[model samples]
Target: MSAAAPPVSSRLFSLFCLASYLLSLSYGSTFLLSLLIGSRGGNELDAGSVISAAMLSTFAAVIVSGHLSDLLGAARSIALFSLLLVVASLGFALTPGFGNLLLFFGLMLGLGWGVFYTLGPIIVASLVTPAQRAKYFALLSGSMMTGIGSGPLLGRAASALGYPVTAAFYLAALASLIGALLFWRLDVQLKKTPSASASVARISWHATARVLSSRAVFPIIMVGLGGCVFGGLSSFQTSYAASRSLDYSLFFFGFMGAAISSRMLIAGFVVKRDPLRASCLLSGLMMVSILMFGFVVDDGFSYVLAAMMLGVGYGLTYSVINGLAANEAPSGTTSQSLLLFSLSYFVGVFGFPLLAGRIIVEHGMVTLLLTVLTIALLNWLITVGRLIWRHVSRIKTLQQA
Candidate 1:
């Protein structure tokens, strides 16, 4: 057998966490892009279309960047993407009008986020041992969630302080520039460590297809559904809150607070105990939370509660499902599995917003909520089905013996 991989140094891991925070902070702030579009005389459909176009670009970028990371190295790929993010953010801040140019900026944003998120776990996975993966992933996720959560609050603060909401884009640009520099430094640091495994070999297309078609399908589908719920909620949040005359910050605070807390405190334990069962339970909570948000949330208290419920449900479920994807990856296809997992999620997170935006414009927020609720239900059913399938498979093995 080959020599064991070197353990990731605490300093290196800390740096990774910081960079992740900055990158996601940039992304999270852009959650206000809908508001930005509104300021530019665009409506929900325009915002959704722009954002959806970005997601499509992200879809393409994830595929390209995953291969590029394997070929060029993760740090370099991330740094390059960070620079793109900086450009995109600045474009949003400096550019005038809401037209096709916004779509171009959206593409740039998608490409940047696509690479940063996809390569992040791959880098972490390589550095840590299998035993350390869950804990480290959870910690990394917390940093990311914290940044994402902080972005909106920063915007709210900016607006309250008499700054234009578009100022958030400028701040996002600065964060991306700083993150790029740190990642560049990381690349130099890794180059000095002769034993560092900074990149993986590229797998064949056929091998990739096989892995995606296998047990990886479960996590892919679940994460995609989760993405749909998240995209629908976040992308249209400004409009949704307006319809009810509620403050949108509550949703951000409640969702991010609960998500970050659960990932840090309880995610590893829940995943360890029984991932499938945990997924089923959490997804059910997600459905209920959506229902509450749709039907019951009229005031701040109820809205915050629903947001928190959705946070815990979707947040923990994401962690658990991610673990399942990694665990169920066949043989040497771990990287491919993770890449596909990210892609599937991008489809839901980015793709659904386009449809959801139209739904809100034409049908109404209630219809949109019902659609997302159905997705959550489908996600829960899949987890339950997977659990039953596993039990049946075990029983068949026992009978054969």
Candidate 2:
């Protein structure tokens, strides 16, 4: 006899809660790291490089975890990774020195995050019917936005309360532990990996190669480009606000709030209708928002308005792309398709920031935002062009028939 699995709704609710909590922990930790690193004799470039390294590590881990999750099962893999998340958070909170920060907080924490992120979607796709994917993913995105929105405020409150940095980190660590325990409690197993020899499982080159050649690559590229826009914002917004004497916490709050609202209210409608069109529209809006940031420096209200636009654009784009990538997964290769999707975003997150760091350090955030705006426009054009080409081909085929 086996234990009964929890209802899909319950399991989804648990996952959603976990996603929210973990994202909060992540955003708060990043904010703390920027301040801590700067106070300890590092600069903006150092912080950017550190964040880039973390995202790069996540990219690597996601590639490997996809195969591992398929082999060990998503629930089991999530439970295992959640423990790493807990340990890493505690280590980050307790350890001192730059080397330790890079090791525990950057690399170790990233590995855990990569696994959790990849497996969460896999499990969600398995649990729900296809029709429900867009809606549920929107909810999941909303939950993440909620976390992102609150994380900065949590940090600000802790700072205002004169809490020791150590205490603040401890709270984040506790949240990770709770998330781990929740994942451990899930009883769902919607699909099992095909049995294979240990050696075959060890070498996943075949799976990687197959996914690279599949149709999912288009969405993967699109998502990666979209990530470049948000990655720049995430890595620099706080620093940018600080440089301008603006309240970063309030601005981030506005950004995340708009993001959550957009995902909850608009993501499903857009994604369900046509992913490519949504991608183009959202990408264009992101471009406009980034451009707006350049001019809104003096006015706090304008700054907040720009942040809201950025939030809504990024929030909607993120979930829409994820759902599209998941739906594009081929038979027996869902995990691999998802790997490509995750890998692309992290690539953008890592590469964009790392490249923009030099510009930020040299010229200014104004120059960086303009550069990012160009990239965003290119991404939008590419996606829209593809959609137009696809439509043209379909019409030609119909005429021939």
Candidate 3:
């Protein structure tokens, strides 16, 4: 026996694993519908805008939702949010007439994701030990990737079945329903735990304000910036696929699948090692990956490269930052810290792709790719510089002491 591998919370790992599976299923089902819409008549700019609008919804709602979690607690918030997601996804499929795709999708998506973005991490935190976060997060990533990696293939399936974009919406709703069910169960389990049952006074917004202004905030923000850049450019992956004359839905497979798998393996290892150093290394890789996207003249070859690079960046770097943000969160500040971390990252998701959309429409794909390269490189440099500064400062302090 391997000393029984020590005691572990099955509930915590199970919840993360289950949630990951459901969310990926939801991602796969909905993403294909969105792509189908783009294929029908939506231009790259339009498609990009629509997707960004949905992300914008989550971005906008993250803070308030998180703050709410601190008051009502993670389990309740998660339950409420996951329910909303299920309803919204189902209702969106039924919403027939479309005019301003951006406005409608954005509002609905924001509402749905706001709930998810706000509570998912808080729930995970409640379930696991602080030290176990990286490993758990990796497990979550892997589960999600295993499901999400198959998202594009959902499109292939939809296309084969001749399901229109509208029909795909119904399928997405089904996936969301499954995910919501898992979340509901997870919330119930969380509430049953002795740890979660203890009463703590609700966190006031005034104190919340102070927590966000601390030293750790800087590191969190820096990590968030890098995340945002990576996320924002990714918002255009579907559009980029369309531009290449390849199947837009299929393109997601290459990137997301690789990303999901990479994180599954890397998150735990780096978290246990030096999370910050892992972040720096991954940041360099991300910059190289983004820059590599710029030189792809051949559509097929470039996608393969792009997918591998993205997977590596996401697996190694994305995991590092996520782990660090959670690991470094201060007392009574986990909700706020995770939410803020999410907020900055989404700002990238909302802003970066919109910029890319404009670039794709006005400047062209090559220009857009180059622009992504520039932004990613800038983020990489700033992040790297900060890590070096932090390391040197720590060494000097020790020497002086």
Candidate 4:
């Protein structure tokens, strides 16, 4: 007897896991590059600019592709975007010099990342039932965290192979190819039974802009601010450690380890009911973690503890926000909402770090931390305050009517 093949749902789930992993790996690999770019006679701010540029590219792709996914279909769009990842990975591995890295890694690869990250959840959302949304969403986040956690380790291993640093890009390229193949297979499976959502009528650009700018959508946007926090921490943690004479490797180990664990534990709590409540809870934790990052200067234990706090905060925050966005997406604008949510996140991931880099250059890391902390604090207050006010107003209106 032949072995049984896995069901389509299982296959798509696995593909999603692989795609998310590659995305993390690509990002982690770039994390290492950011450090090296500074040491290679380049300014830290310049290196940060490169990362920001890539994210900017991702930002553009996300806004455009979110709507495109509705028209061309998610699986096909993912496969199409994965091809760019593959090419960019190869270019990063083979190209020599900083300018090329910016061209391929920052711009081209960012475009691929924007589309893949935005659509991965949409594809998964279409595959599962409403009851399974939170569970599957958590699973996706877990897979992504695992990949991100391991990416730095993989880059370190590649560096140990006695090859030029570009070899890490080669390793990342191989992973990208694997991801592309997985997405292609997923596309084939999705073609079997077309998703009901696959046929949502395409909204015009003006409508897309209005949905993104609306007040009702602002809370979800606030929830997505976790991306900026995550971005700032990931991009600058190494430098922060160097400034304090702490070990970068140990700090990252603690951060990723805590993040992976927290995501697993928090996954069960992200149910469909009350996703906003979950978002509020996670946002508070994130604010606390950001505060802790400011004091990790002298003691090793504090550094590790701060990393753990950051991990837990970052992990749960992302999961909760994405879940909330999915639940709150409009009847015909689910894809658009998700895209907007992702757009807000990438803006933080890329945009915040870019701003922070400039601040660090002029005022030092202390000022940078203070600035971030202030912003995080304000965001928490506004997010929670508005949510409560809106809820009470809704109740009063219902009673009066």
Candidate 5:
């Protein structure tokens, strides 16, 4: 019933295509980091450091960007940050050495990444009404998941083409360029057309804090618990996929291909129905997918299937919870609550995966997978517990009334 729920036209729909592409590039550029390093004579440790650097940067700055989305329009901020990403991609692809690599990939690249994520969800909320957010968010999630799911295959193609890192970086940069342009165009459109529903108030920090502290916090926590499994996959998918002897960028890309396809196809429909329930369902899928992947040895079909399932799980869940936060967020509190949500998710992404990697070292692959499954199971339990609590509380209130 919010005024934001006006009928969307085809042109409005075009905005999603751009979102998908930009997210795809963001993921793609990061996916091929290992190949970039390997091509330049770096070793596994070096590659690990670079990847960590980016994640570190992303986790550290998400809040700042989220807060800043108020001063800077989400669309404009994303566009400008993406421009930085383009430069960083070029820097990593064209430059040399561990220090310079860290400089661009760690700092510039991370900050650019910070911008994309910060603005992305806010803009997503802006595009849809509170009630509609789950469905639209799912669509955007699918687009991003589908695009990035194509990562390993695209990485392989780059490697095969003789300049693996360069090729992938170029494609990612191109995709991002289009995304930036589309975002800019969206900004322009907003300025010129002027929706009958005037814009909501700028995002508010005080409002954001309360939303972050709401009843919805439980679901966000549950998702974070479940997200540990995906975090592991994102970190090691490329390096793990490639030959120990040869840097096969295709390994991770192939895995991404399967994951993205499933997301793009099913995510929108899933969210449209009931985003919260869809996320709950995805928690189950996460258990199955992580369990299946525990057995994957090298870059193979099992790994692909596992990746696909993880993609499904993530695609199914992320935006649902995000939509919930956006919906429950007060009139002017979009960015902060979402920032809190991102912080929770990224913490899992950056920290747990590192733990998993250590598990990979100590416990072996199958055991490591079991760890992931355990994490998923933890999430499932969290969801059930919270739902039960809500149900019981409602029943008690009804009895009292």
Candidate 6:
């Protein structure tokens, strides 16, 4: 048998985690793009459309960048995407109108995010053994959550200081530039200490089909549902807060706090021990959180509580489902499986917001919340079903033996 892969360097891993944090910081700051749209005399629909356009770009980018990562290597592909994000963030700050320019910049931002998010887990998977995957994944995600959670606060600080909300985009640009440089350094290190698992190979359509049809389907579907819930909640948060007469920042704070804490504390322990069962429990929590947000939240405390519930539920659930996808992937198709997983998530995260915007403009925030709750319920049911199926299959094998 081939020798076990060498341990990942502590310095290299630290660089990777820091780069992920900075890149996500940039992404999280753009969550305030709705504020910019409102300031420019545009409505929810405009913001949704622009965000949707970006998601569409993200979809395309995930596909292209996956192939490029396989061709050019992960660090180089990530560095290139980081530069694109820098350009988009700068464009958002400099551009005046909320029309084509906004959409173009949004697309650029999506492209950058799509590549970074897809490659991040793949890199972690390559560097670590199967047993260590969940722990490292949690660490990486925690770093990302910290950055994402801090972004809205940064925007709020900018606004408080009488600067335009778009000023956050300038900070985002700076962060992206730094992240790009770090990734470049990572590329140099990778060359000096090449990983055996990091061999460059073209992705085949045959492998892609196998991954989609394999057990990977379960996690992909679950993550997509989680993305839908997240996309709807986040994209329409400003409107929801207005309707509740609450502060939007509370939601971000609660979510960020809960997500980071859960990932850092419980993700490795829970996800490694029967990911499907953990996913089912988390999905139930997610459903309850959505219900609280929709029907039970009447005060700031309730709202923050609801957001925290969602943070733990969806946050841990995502890490669990991601591990499932990576672990369950067919041989020689880990990259393809992750690419599809990212694509499914982008569809829900970006695609649903487009519809949610119109729903809020025409129907109302209540209707939107109700719709999101329904999606969460479906997600829970899927996990429960998968768990049951696994249990029954094991019983059948035992009996036959």
**What C-alpha lDDT do the candidate models reach, one value each?**
0.82, 0.68, 0.60, 0.68, 0.62, 0.82
Of the candidates numbered 1 and 2, which has the greater TM-score value? 1
Q: Which tens-of-lDDT digit does each residue in 225-310 have in candidate 1?
A: 99999888987887888899998889899998898878767876875777788889999999999999888999999999998998
Tens digits of per-residue lDDT, candidate 3, 1-401, equal: 12222334686667657765665554444444435545556555665565567666775566467465667666555555655555545554554443474357556655666566546655555556676666766666567656655655665676679965555555555666677666666655666665442322234566457556665565466655664565545556666666667665444666666676566565556677776667667777777766666665247766666666766766566556666676566666665666676666666655455566677779887887776666666656766777788889999999999
Worst 10 residues of 4 by lDDT: 1-10
Candidate 1 C-alpha RMSD relative to the actual structure: 2.0
Candidate 5 lDDT tens digits, 1-401: 35655555557656755565565665555656555666677644455456555667776567567445556556677777777777776676677665654554556666676667655665666655666667666666656665665544566676567855566676777777887888877776654433322333333566656776775576568657755766666656555544333343333444455445555676557666654456678777877777666554344555656666666666666766777766665555665666666666656654565566566556655666677778788887766776677789999999999
Minimum summed lDDT over a 10-residue window in model 5 is located at 194-203
lDDT of 3 at 24: 52
- TM-score per candidate: 0.94, 0.87, 0.84, 0.86, 0.83, 0.95
Best by TM-score: 6
lDDT of 6 by residue, 152-229 (tens): 777778878998888888898899899988997888787666443564333467877898889998889878888889
Q: Candidate 3 — which residues are off by over 4 angstroms?
A: 1-8, 27-34, 66-73, 87-98, 145-149, 165-167, 197-212, 297-302, 398-401
What's the C-alpha lDDT at position 4 in model 1? 66
Query: What's the C-alpha lDDT at position 287 in model 1?
Result: 91
- What is the full ranking by lDDT, best candidate first? 6, 1, 4, 2, 5, 3
lDDT (tens digit, per residue) of candidate 4 on 212-320: 6655376456744666677777777767877888766666777778866765665675554475566567677767777777864477888888777777766766766
Write model 2 residue lDDT over 138-185, tens digit each, in one string.
777677567656655666777779975555566666776676666665
Clashing pairs in 1: none
Please identify which of the two predictions, 4 or 5, would achieve the higher lDDT against the true structure.
Answer: 4
Worst 10 residues of 2 by lDDT: 193-202
Candidate 4 stretches greater than 4 Å from native? 1-8, 66-72, 93-97, 158-165, 193-196, 199-203, 213-216, 270-273, 394-401
Q: Give Cα distance to truth, residue 338, candidate 2, Å.
A: 0.8
**Residue range with the least summed lDDT across 10 consecutive positions in model 1:** 194-203
Ranking by TM-score: 6, 1, 2, 4, 3, 5
Q: What is the C-alpha RMSD of each candidate to the true structure, in Å?
A: 2.0, 4.4, 4.0, 4.5, 3.7, 1.9
**Model 1 CA lDDT for position 180:** 90
Query: Candidate 1: where are CA atoms >4 Å away?
Result: 1-7, 191-198, 201-203
